[model samples]
Target: MSVRSTAFIPAVFKNLTFWVLIAIISGVLVGHFTPETGKGMKVVGDIFISIVKVFIAPIIFLTIVLGIGGMGDLRKVGRIGLKALLYFEVVTTFALGIGVAAAIIIRPGHISRAGLDINDASDYTSKAQQAFDWWEFFKTNITLQALILAIIVGIALNYFSQRERIVATLYKISGFVFKLLKLIMWLAPVGAFGGMAYTVGKFGLQSLLPLGKLMLTMYLTMAIFIFLILGAILRFYKIRIMDLIRYLKPELLIVLGTSSSEPALPNLIHKLERMGCSKPVVGLVVPTGYSFNLDGTSIYLSMSVIFLAQLYDVHLSFTQILTIVGLLMITSKGAAGVTGSGFVILASTMTAIHSIPMEGLGFIIGIDKFMSEARAVTNFMGNAVATIAISKNEGDFVDREHSLNIE
Candidate 1:
């Protein structure tokens, strides 16, 4: 059956996106007028994100396990994983290059550093001083751990004599998890309100004036990457980028509101499956992409590096720029599943470069929260596109608009 359509009036009021938009506007007003009250609203957002996170591990485990178990092909599973990693590497490299190019052209760091705040960066800097280890990353990243475990369980189940029964049981559990997730999602507007309020309350809108150029550069660069680079990739696969985006509007709104993609992760999987992407492709790609395919974060980190060099009047040679790209190729994978990881990754990269002053990080701290929504949204879109592309590549996709009258 096709998705049911309601009359415009009832649709607008009942729509989650409409409420989220209103919440975001209300949050801005609250934060701008009464900063203390806005700051206090943080718990409302935090609790919502936390409640959503409760489903993440289980959903990842169940979905991936079920997908792979259904596939019953160990070799195909490995191939999809490899292809996904390869796609992530290539696209993120382009994202980094675009970021660096934009920063150089825009020259956002030309403003005086005297007005930039440097005190707030101490926490991220201290965290950056510690080395990044894959083992440590795997240990700390519950998502990665869940992904790996799911693959193993899925592969193991392929050989089980009663695999069909186990899969049937797991499918029922999966249905229950998603139903609960649907109910929990009604709190998204509240979460969005709290998130926006906390951000604006903590860092007032006036703060954007001083670093407006950098903020503009960031948003502009991401827009280019989304429309030009990512758009091309989707188009090449015979998929309309705008169509995919419009279809994902609700999840995108949730991500924009939360400034954290995790809240939308389950929904993305559910929606992609609804769009006729195979369970295996969505399950395998989405969680893996969260860690490896952070298009927005790559752009931000690359631009931040260049922005810092320009801010400090430190000239980066062509070779140094390449080195930054190469370094980020490795470092950006660590961006997911950690709080303030973007800053932490930036700090670590700067420390390794030893040319740009590590203190420059504090300069952008005021507006980082504002940019995070964009980062999360871009990352969310990148993962979705990746899933669809991979699904088509594996001959595993069906266009729901044609088959199920999804439109």
Candidate 2:
């Protein structure tokens, strides 16, 4: 082969996507064969996630502050924030509706509930029984709290006479943080390997069969939401969803392996900017979306609720279903930073409705880890597409032709 042609091959092999793919395959093998050793690999993933998280707060603060400060229009910042929130609501509502519809149609929980392992869900139920206070939620949710503080600081900086100097310093720091992120991301394959190995090793494939129907239904619903709903929105903007997904493959893999969208947050912010989203839109929308726009989490929440209702043979009225969707719209926003937020939200939703048994959560907790990958991947992609759409709407997106060609 010509040297030029051979050079492309080496670059392909060196690509992060290539390594992530290999790591995922190797992880499955190790998990399936040496389950005990694979289980111990959890620390590798945890360490990588911790390292990535160390930069999240700073990066978000700088990105939003710089994005808002540099925009030179406080009204535009408010407009973008409002628009992003509105967009998140409409899309996530659609996600919840679709999830409920899919569960109703598929009837994943229509079978016998016998032979299901039931854990003590008293902890979840007890917490769920408590009233959901916005004050409490704000106090507990670190991401939402950071986002609010960043916006205040960003808006305050807009009026500061010395804003330029501070913004410039933040930009320098942003550069350093992102550069550090680049170094941290090279460990992605190791993290992916460890995360996947531990999950499969600890849970085992057999554990999934009992709840396989629910798992499959959730995945199917998210796939439809992404390719159909999100895709149509992107098409309206002259962008291909598949192309965007292809562009975001590495980050998606990281989310898949980690089963938490968080590990990829910093990298996603940088990539979105590179893909032509204006910094302000990327900063404001992405972090906010983590809290406000959880399409994947919304879908999972609704479907799981419906699945449990069906599992317990508890028939819900149309009013009850609508109530479930409405409650989810609020509860889902509080999901971002809470540990076991999914189960907690599910428990809370059931408690409020007084329909499904909170005890039913025990039936699926074993497989929750497996299902979380779907939620994380869908949530990650939903936020990415939202950033692009919002940027394009605000006339902040650039390099349309060139960015569309990103492979």
Candidate 3:
């Protein structure tokens, strides 16, 4: 609650972020030392992520449709919605460019030594090739075309949602999501333990070394996006962004534990309301933001693609690279901020750019986790910024409370 409270922490000097960092570090350490336990630990993280996931679809639907439908004059949203969407696009595209540039310059993943498992990954080549094989997965995940279908379904549901009979049904569906979230969170402790143990068991501490730059860069960039980009936007509304951050603490922690942002939707809703944002606005902006404003995934898709290309010494003409970037921008939007979303888009990106073989994915498979931290942070910052931007433009900006003001 207070900086003094953070000072009382036994594990680190202070702060919630520090504690989560410690938890992650400890998990990684424990997971690596005992690779035999990695399987079980991985399950913990997976289960935790799954628990939060059940809430995603319903939350997205209710939040967006209600937010929009509740807007009595839809035309009034033109300025807010369009401007907010524009911000998401510009910021996310810049992030992707930064990632690609970073990868090309650093070549962080390419310095494989003689004794390194350059050849061992041969066993993993097929596994890697699968990443670029978008067609095979498109059939299974339903994330591609089905994603648009979900919007259509949401639209249809909203039409019925207006009638009394359908309103009751829609509310019932929302209730189901709440129940699912509860059932899953009940198992979080077990899941957290398992996930952390798995990280420690599998790679131990050694894995962190290779991914150090990526982890640090991602974290630092996330901070910049929040304090600078998001902060500047919030300041325009004369609201303290850190106050918003504080309100969303619960959801943020849940995201950290599971590395999945979807699970935190309900909490985000509750926080936004408490901060004086109208319920309809929170519902509409947040869910739609999940799909359209995934700033983090944009960066990751490009960074990883560039990283992999460099890792394998693949050459890309400027025209070829620009095509990949443009294609990725389309494919990466609306990507869920979950463990596998980056991979999903990567698979699609490779398909679009025939230059890279599907098997090329295996090169960085071992390091995706490190890359994910960066991606998740970006996604989180983007949504938070979008909510504020929309609220300001809609004349719904509320300055109810202040919890932190580091800037």
Best by lDDT: 1
Candidate 1: which pairs clash? none
* Residue pairs in clash, model 2: none
Task: State the lDDT of candidate 1 residue by residue for 135-245, as single tens digits.
Answer: 877788788888889989999999999999999999999999999999999999999999989888987887668788898999999988888888888898877778888
Once superposed on the true structure, which residue ranges of model 1 sit more than 4 Å away at CA?
1-8, 337-339, 402-407
The digit string of per-residue lDDT tens for model 2 on 1-407 reads 89999999989888988898888888888998999988999998788777777777777778788878888799999999999989999999999999999999999988666556665455666777886777877787666767889999999998899988998888898898889889889998998899889888887787568788898988989999999999999999988899988888888888887788888888788889888999888988998888888899899999999998999999999998999999999888878732256777777677787767768778767777788888888889899999999999998888656774565
TM-score (C-alpha, index-matched) for candidate 1: 0.94
- lDDT: which is higher, 2 or 3? 2
Each model's lDDT: 0.86, 0.85, 0.63
Candidate 3: Cα lDDT at 33: 65
lDDT of 3: 0.63
Q: Once all C-alphas are superposed, what RMSD does model 1 give against the true structure?
A: 3.1
Tens digits of per-residue lDDT for model 3, 114-224: 223333245445443443544654565432343445445545554554545554565677667766665555555455456566655754566556555655655665666
Kindly report which residue stretches of model 2 are placed more than 4 angstroms away from their true locations once superposed: 1-9, 120-133, 337-340
- Candidate order by TM-score, decreasing, is 1, 2, 3
